[model samples]
Target: MKQLMDLANRDPLARRWAKNCAFDLMFGVGDDHYQVEVRGGQIEAMRERPSKLTSWDFAIAGPQSSWQAHWAPVPAPTFHDIIAMRTAGHITIEGELTGFFANILYVKRMLELPRIEGWLQ
Candidate 1:
């Protein structure tokens, strides 16, 4: 989670578009659960909770092992594509989809951050 925050903090694009947005991540694959919060493109908080009740303006869910694959650069699997996938049942989401497509470019730029290079691989 620190790594993700580091990436977001250093990302010019993330900083730009996250100006008024509050995003959260909730994931778990057994006894371990992790939650991360990002507001104004910076990490506001993080923690490991026994339950996954954390909320945010947006959220994505899936196995942690799928992170790299889901984030990998692909011609059709861009962040927008991910959102579509989630809506189509390829993945799962627990938030609003409105205006999500409008933020695709910003999302792409954030994914290009160097700190998150490993996740993209």
Candidate 2:
């Protein structure tokens, strides 16, 4: 995931897309969780969840299996999207939604970055 962020930080398109966005997104894969901090469209940090009381704009969590499928080169139906994963009960999204919605495109594109380089495969 750190690699993904690094690559994204160097991506011109990604930077442009998220230029005005800023937030901390908590992403969980099974028992592990990461806090991805974004400011001005650049991924400033990707690290383990800081603490229970750490403030985050929103969170996206799911089992390892769900994420594996979602990151597959050719994701199966419903596994191809975050909303679909939520609707399918494969993942849960919580916390403040305004930030998530406001930068929905960036969130989706950032999560899908792995697909571009086939990193998860």
C-alpha positional error of residue 78 in candidate 2 after TM-score superposition, expressed in Å: 0.5
Assess every candidate by TM-score.
Answer: 0.62, 0.93
For all candidates, what are the clash counts? 0, 0
Question: What is the Cα-based lDDT of residue 29 in candidate 2?
Answer: 90
Model 1, span 1-121: residue lDDT tens = 5676677777776878767665565543234556666566566776777254555454556554344455555524433355565565554555665434445555545544532465554
Q: After superposition, how far is residue 8 of candidate 1 from its true place, in Å?
A: 0.4
Predicted candidate 2 versus true structure: per-residue lDDT over 23-90, tens digit per residue: 99999999999999998888899988578887899999999999889989999999999999999999
Candidate 2 TM-score, C-alpha based = 0.93
